[model samples]
Target: MARRKTREEIKTQDKWNIEKMYPDNASAEKDLKESVSDAEKYGKYKGHLADSAESLADALIESDRIEQKLERAFVYSRMKLDEDNRAAEQQALYSKAAAAISQVSSLTSFVMPELIRIPEETLKQFIEDEPRLQTYRHLLDSAMRQKDHVLSEKEENILAQLGEVLSAPDQVFTMLNDADMKFGKIKDEEGKETELTHGNYISFMRSQNRQVRKDAYTHCYEAYKGMINTISANYSANVKTDVISARLRNYPSARAAALSSGRIPESVYDNLIDSVHSALPKMYEYVKLRKKLLGLDELKMYDIYVPLVKLPKKKIRFQQAVEIGKEGLAPLGDAYLQQFQKGIDSRWIDIYETEGKTSGAYSFGSYDSDPYVLMNFDSTLEDVFTLVHEMGHSMNSWLTRKTQPYVYGGHSIFTAEVASTVNETLLMKHLLKTESDPEMKKYILNMYLDAFKGTLFRQTMFAEFEKKTHEYAENGGGLTADWMNKTYDELNTEYFGPALSHDDYIQYEWARIPHFYNSFYVYQYATGYSAANAIADRILNGGEKERDDYLKFLSLGSSDYPVELLKVAGVDMSQREPVDRAMKVFSGLVDEFAELMEE
Candidate 1:
């Protein structure tokens, strides 16, 4: 068996230069101390937010500065911890950062409620009178929208101080999943023993060897099955937290509270489900095609992930994958590509999977720091896509932070997902157009089809589960292990249709997903996939105008409402046209796949 590499064993160039954030642990602690001091400075401005235009402007700027320090400190610590969860020193750094952030939150809890106390007319007058406040026009307007939801300063302080407690479920699950639990071992495709990890589980599921896939699937979920009771309890607590927090904030539902900050309408959420529900038949047809190609007596949950258009085994090494990503993303023009290359050269990515590292791909960092990416690269073609997907996210942050003010220096979760998926869509387009191998072309098509199924259909299923489970808890239904398993089982049965048979243990799959910790986040993957398809199509089919427009959209950050911001990129997400267009693209891909296979 090949031993998993430890954090220390990985080469320096292969890892992100997280030290760029702070020179050492002492420097990180110093940053936290600075944040705490800056947060304390907010006390003088607390009750006087509405006093004068200059006073309001100064207070808002100071608040952004305080948050900037706090976020940078927290991000640095969390990234260190994520690199290797088993390291005790890293764990302490993370706990310290988390505690400091909680303290900072409590200190600044008065800003919103106090700002809310000021009359809207007074805020507008302040905006007009204070030239400095002019830059914060959008910020003030956005904060004002939360007027009804802002709790009193004292109550908000209590909630903020309980921040760590509220987040405990996610932290506990992280330790259990990443640090403690083991999925044991399985035989590799070469018939050698290997460990089954959250990182490699998907790669194994993509195996052409059926026995390998089934063993990997069974071994992975059976471990979760063992901890099912504990996981369900944590998950239920997490859901209840969402419900209670939303109610406390006077939201009609938890989902409303989740979306309110982004100013997204409930209709967008409902529209995604309805649109995906309408398109489920297309997904079912794609499934039938998969089963027929595999020539299986009956397909099961394990069978679903294997690519129908099997090609020769080829490992896309990390360096080569980056080159492919660079070429595929060229439509974004020279400026975008230059910064991307610089990030690559500067070690903005943590490139390989190591023992005890977090088991997924994500782009995250503080606004002041480089937008760092953590990936579990396994050299599959899908891993190449994952690389580009994360780079897309980092690029969004890089551009936004470089362009927008500190307060607006991040992409809304809704638009953030679009930025990432657009890269996936564009890469597939580039691959199909450039590659000449008929089999490889078929494979790319298969990948694209599956991306649609995975992002558009699978994530929507997960989204539906989030919505239903939260609603259930809000309605007083208990989320026991048995109940969760039943709910998940029904979703799989409905989504995949008769083409796939069920593995009894597949029901426990929900317990393992980390995104459930972030309520209402998965649906953005679906909605974003839909919106990104439109944006990617426009860029590929149109000219410089489309590409530049899209880049501008990425740079806007949270300066405007997400739906309105999407329009700058020529994608109108406020309407159903984007989802409908994505469905059409899926149907076309399925037809093309059907043709290629028949030939």
Candidate 2:
């Protein structure tokens, strides 16, 4: 087996040029420490937020300056650590950054509660009275919306001081999963053995070789199974923390707190679950069709990812994939494509998996830095899709950072997912329209169907599990390894239906999902995919106005409520129609795929 390369062994071009953000660790540490004094500047406005319009505007602007510096420091340190989790020096740098930010949080904890305490009439007049305060109308509005959940200043300060302690469960899980857990090795399709890592697990599952798929699945879950007890306890602690924090702030439930923070309606979450439940029959039909197409008597979990309609194998290498992505995503217009190309040329991507690298992909950077993407590219067509997906996120950041102020410069997961998935949608549409070969077209169709299955059906199931488990903890029930496994397994069976033959490996799945620690975040993938489908259709079928609207939406950042911001793109997420429409699309695609396979 080939040994995984160390960080230094990876090619220079394949890594992100993060040095542009900070020269070295010493510089990052220096900035982090200096930001401590900047945080203290907030003390000057503590008692005088409601004193006058000018004072209020000045305080908010000063806060933005301090936050920008702190964010840059935090982002630099974390990105450095993400490159190699085992590096002690990087770990220390990250710890210092986290501590610095937490201290800043402690120093400025009075800001939100104090803002909330101002009378609404007074606050409105302050905005009307000060022209400078116009920049913060939405910010103040958002704060007022959450006023019911704002605790006393002292309590807020206490929580800020305990920030790192409250984050212990997530930190413990990260260290254990990324640095400690090992899945050993598995035999590849040609009987050559290869090391099994998180980056290649999905590739193994999609291997035409069934035994390779089964082996990868078994080894991956078995490692989690070994640490299930610890994982369950750690996850329980995370849930407890979330519940207690929400209760302390007077939220009805942890879910309510999560949704309300972004001004999203709880009905949107429920609508996703309810709509997907109605569509599960179609999912079962697809699974049954998959079993028939594979000529298998029973479809096991490992059998799900292998493409049902086989196309000729071709290696889509990194450069080729980026070119294809450029072509596929060209419909987003020249301005968007130009920035994407610049990102490509500027070394804004870290492209490949190496020893001790964080698994999965993300687009990350502070407002002052280029939006950078981290990927594990194995040159599959699916990896091309991933490249475009993360680039979508980076493009969103790039546009938002250039156009919006620091306060609205980031994304709520709600709108963030839409940006990423829109790229995926456009890329798929491009492939389907341009590819001429019958088999290749069939493969593209298969990929599209699987995406719907994964995002709509699969993520909704995950959303339900998150909801149920949180409710369990809220009701004083223990989330032991056995109970979580049982709950997750039942959900799998319910979602996958009778076509799926259960395995022990399938139930341990929840233990391995890092997203569970993120609370109600997974549901956005489903919601966003739904919204993207609509937006993509508009751009393709409608006029230049439709394209302009989406571009504007991407630039809006968090300037408005997430659902309202999505309206700028012509998709209303508050209604269930988007999910219903997405379900219809899935149903049509399933019909098309089954007919092609049967032919």
| Among all candidates shown, the one with the greatest lDDT | 2
TM-score, model 2 to reference:
0.99
What's the residue-level lDDT of 68 in candidate 2? 93
Error of 1 at 245 (Å): 0.7
lDDT of 2 at 435: 90
Q: What is the TM-score of each candidate against the true structure?
A: 0.99, 0.99
Any runs in candidate 1 off by more than 4 Å, and if so which? none
Off by over 4 Å in 2: none
lDDT of 2 by residue, 1-599 (tens): 75678888888888999999998999988889888998876698999999999999999999899889989989999889889899999999999988998899999999999999899999999999999999899999989998998899999999999998898888788889988899999999888889999899999999998999999999999999999999999999999998999999999999999998788888999999999999999999999999988999878999999998776678888999989999988888888888898999899999989999999999999999999999988889999999999999999999999999999999999999999999999999999999998888999999999999899888899999999999999899988989999999999999999988988789999988888889999999999999999999999999889999999999999999999999999999989999999999999999988888767
lDDT of 1: 0.91
